[model samples]
Target chain A: MWDYSETVKEHFFNPRNAGAVADANAIGEVGSLSCGDALRLTLKVDPATDTIQAAGFQTFGCGSAIASSSALTELIKGMTLDQALHVSNQDIADFLEGLPPEKMHCSVMGREALQAAVANYRGEVWQDDHEEGALVCKCFAVDAVLIEETIRANGLSSVEAVTHYTKAGGGCSACHEGIEEILTRVLAEQGKTFDPAAAPPPADKSGSAGARLGTLARIRRIEHAIEAIRPNLQRDHGDVELVDIDGKNVFVNMTGACAGCQMATTTLEGIQQRIVEDLGEFVRVLPAQAMPQTTNNQ
Target chain B: MTQAPAGIYLDNNATTMVAPEVVEAMLPYFTEQFGNPSSMHQFGDRVGRALKTARQQVQALLGAALDSEIVFTSCGTESDATAILSALKAQPERREIITTVVEHPAVLSLCEHLEKEGYTVHYLRVDRKGRLDMQQYLDALSSKVAIVSVMWANNETGTLFPVEEMAELARSAGVMFHTDAVQVVGKIPIDLKRSAIDMLSLSGHKLHAPKGIGVLYLRRGTRFRPLLRGGHQERGRRAGTENSASIVALGKACELALAHMDAEKTQVRMLRDRLERGILAQVPNAFVTGDPSNRLPNTCNIAFEYIEGEAILLLLNKAGIAASSGSACTSGSLEPSHVMRAMDIPFTAAHGTTRFSLSRYNTVADIDRVIAAVPPIVAQLRRLSPYWDASAGAPLAEPETAFQPAYA
Candidate 1:
């Protein structure tokens, strides 16, 4: 239930191109049964035109992964090999409308398998043994190229946005600084300027009439509570994030550790209430129910 | 919601409703006999005797030498943790531990934690049908290995492990062995005296008893340390106020298990087999998980490959069938089951895995209702699936040749 876009759901539920080609020139297989996802691609190429005449795939994965594979297949079907080669993981993500942050790897897997398949067809070796580029995210096997491409395609303007696309800053957050560097480099290459002085000031700090002192204090108090509770939440398979502070109504979104928890409402009432109460009665603590639902399974 | 006359209670592996007999046995301890077992009054003595009797019942079920060896714990998790911590503590110098990868989280998560603590942990891989590699297990065990913990039967697959062989190997290595018998305790015959297992854990709710009560058996003369440290409850092993009511219920559950085991196993096995065969014949790509010959009599793990397990479970729940998905735990991590991953089952298959564990109460009519209702559900989910194109194959598509890329 990761709030998959309508398009993503459409492709996932009734996917296009989900079978094997009868006569195919090149095929690529990536991922493993251990990795919890696997993609097998078959392509029938018109060698004279160097264009794919037919394409099909079978994916052994979840809804998102399967959708990514289906999208990848549809994108490249009946296209020239060169055109197919330009189809990036970002294109896959975009075609599906958007994927959940963690699930960008599913699109990445689709892209990698495609690239590998093309490489296999051409009998060409990859120029760089880029394995030594440094491990960015060990859990998901994400690397520098994946992050750079994700940042460029998604228009990731911040460290947090980069995390949303490539999951580079998601796990452990040990590599946040490294991901920031990569993001900076990608943005710079795209001629997007980043200036500390030019950065917009915090909207809350603008001291608008809508911004109440109680709300600001409650927000800060909730932030401290979230930070304190973060580790325990991670252990319990969930996480929390501050969504918004509209006057005295403090809104927070719960994910990972809190999602699907029977005690989620209790956690909000008990813990969030204490923070708001300490801030003052002018503040009202509320879970951000209006936010897009991101439950793991719908 | 309109309630349907207390719907037929199957799915015992998920959890069993507390038995009325067990409830009757527990009623006195809740009110009249409310004194702490440690109190000096005769009221305390009465509750203390209840605890002792419960311990003896559990011990008798396992065929252990003494009731002193059984430790009453809060739940299966605590019992598992106690056994593992004690084993690791006793052999501080030995850093390696061997265990099956298909164990429940109660054991597997502890192994993961121990691994993070710099202990060398070997996960014994299983076959597609979820049978452990005995040769790999023997090869993994050594003088460096302190303990080997495996489940008596898999919760997801219901595949019975070769515990007797595993215990023998551990015994020969002079390493302590523990088995989380939560799923297998009442369903399968377990004789601690005959087997080389040093420790075992069982939960009360998995059987016909109440929750919040569990038994952890330690072989006599085993070098073990207590996990909890406080008052002299549980013979200084688990030092918490005894849940006297639940303990009495658990004892009654044990007696029921012993009396009904034979008839229950035979009847439930037949129903389970009928359910399995009906599904396989009716639904495309529907197959049972684990070694069919070595599975529990009252459980069936079926994978209807294109659909998600949660979706199917939801559909089943709507149809008044209480089934479980190994993929969807109480915690909302939608990752395919670790148990299925350990068995090297493909994620598509793993995502589709659904467990239906039966009990003595389930009947052939219940199985028939499931069989009648399930095919349509599977078909509906498949219609939503990108993978289940009928043109692909009627049944038994070649796995290797099945990966067709739809890309140009």
Candidate 2:
């Protein structure tokens, strides 16, 4: 159901270097169980060479999170602390072919853990945890500084994208407005414009995500409605054939018993009503002969 | 195009495999008996009788006074919509609806819509064991309440609610009562004629029948309004052509369920308990959710601490096992299930909740396979869990762990 990559499944099923380094010099942890993902990275450093001698990770998360952590470990096994810090979330995802866009946060967690470990190795305290910036996503305990950094680093322009990258707006969504404000402020500072329409709102009770469909989607939905209604129409020894669609008008041809029958109007009306209900009330249905020019284009 | 994957399915709460008998009973209707039940011919007459028989079978299963009480619909959601909306329509002056916070989305989503439409909905909370507090439920009921729609059993935790008693209370208060019995009908006995429940909704697939066929049981004397008002289908209650084949399948499935009710309770319950106990014994920091003493016979919701559920399910899938999880990550959301949250389950343990729902089709060997496969998977995930410090035998590596609130 998740469309997880085979490589992700592979690493999750057989995770390498899974567990904490017993006596590691540096340990970095990020995320929490409440956020649906958490990761801890333990790095053993060869101080003379300034290289990561070994890396072990513990991840409490979904398959993608585990896979990303495994990939992070594999990527930074022999790299120096600075080199390991340069391993982006993208690198972890690239190691596993790719992760679903919604699961990108897992890779971000892996990269954050690596950075925290590197910061710890250098005797530098990670700047988060005590930031005075107000908390935005209370569900995930994500505060303003981290959200700003993630938005700026990823050039995130939408709340959904921010959630995917930071696991911030993914819970409760009470902080959606807060996330929007942060996005707008961060994008403005970077001289980039934020588009509010890029991400759609939550689906209504009808389960329809978008209020209106594009031209292609409208045509597809109309065709699907016709497909569903065709079999029932055949039971009455009649059939409806699509001729062409122009603007909001759907042109069709009625065949067999429906062609010149007294009930032809009723049959046409049924088709028109069904199309309108599925597409929208603005849709108009008419006979192909009534609208000839659109037929030739088809 | 390919062979079906061989796996042990334990996701019955999500949906169950269509019973072979139901399939056998439905095959003819798809071919020769495929006539509109509204038609004026012999073909139509045959289908109409089949529809009547199907209604009768469902009526028998629910122990309703008459087959006329059963109104067939598209699915559980449709049945739920028809019931809740019908109640509100019947009592236009009543602006409040009483329901539990742990209801399936079918009811919860409707409540949300109703709330947007200027209706006050009381989402009664559940305790740590996912049980509704009776005192709180009683406090929520008032004359302004149009309908009290609580689930007979929770889908997530399989916790049984006191629906019969609750319905009686609602009846005394002059409020309509509906129960989404989707998770309970086939797994347990129901005698609606003896209960004060005004309406009940059930899905076909949950009872080993095909999907797309559901029933709304409205009592004979109940005031109601139709949700769909087109054709004179289901006595003009629901509109649309009858899913004749599925209706027949549901009837046969109900008959089969009635025949196997004892085994479902005894053998399936035994298997479920064994699996739950086995997993708890083998895996540390794991505990069952809901009232362990009063839950559905064939369902178990277990939370494995430190490790997340999706990772465990993935490994289980690799081991040819099928299950579901309550984790937000599993659903592609950021928060765990509302049911778990309502019960105040710790965010740490909630993320790792897995639901293994059994059906009558499962065997002892299947139960054994799950028991044998779960420990290793838990161990593997725990190994990769930052919270799980095996040497300490407790959750570790946290400055927040000290502040983490304990929840049963």
Provide the overall lDDT of each model, using Cα atoms, as 2-decimal numbers: 0.75, 0.84
Per-residue lDDT for B181-300 in model 1, tens only?
Answer: 999988877788888999999999998899898989998888888999998887788888888999988998998888778965788898888988988888877778888888889889
For TM-score, the strongest prediction is: 2
Question: Cα deviation of A262 in candidate 1 (Å)?
Answer: 20
Residue A189 of model 2: what lDDT? Answer: 93
Error of 2 at A218 (Å): 40
Model 2, B19-129: lDDT tens per residue? 998999999999999899999999999999998898889998999999999999889999999999998998899999999899999999889978968999998988899
Model 2 lDDT at residue A147: 91
Q: What is the lDDT of residue A282 in candidate 1?
A: 41
Candidate 1 lDDT, A1-298, residue by residue in tens: 3556878767765667777778878887764443345677778889999888888876655567778888999899889988998887878988999776556667877887887778779986433222213347644446777787777775666765555444455556787767767866777888976442343222232233354456455567667756765665664457777787665566778897478665565556544534543443444556788433432221
Poorest stretch of ten by lDDT in candidate 2 chain A: A200-209
Off-target runs (Cα >4 Å) in candidate 1 are A1-298, B1-10, B328-331, B390-408
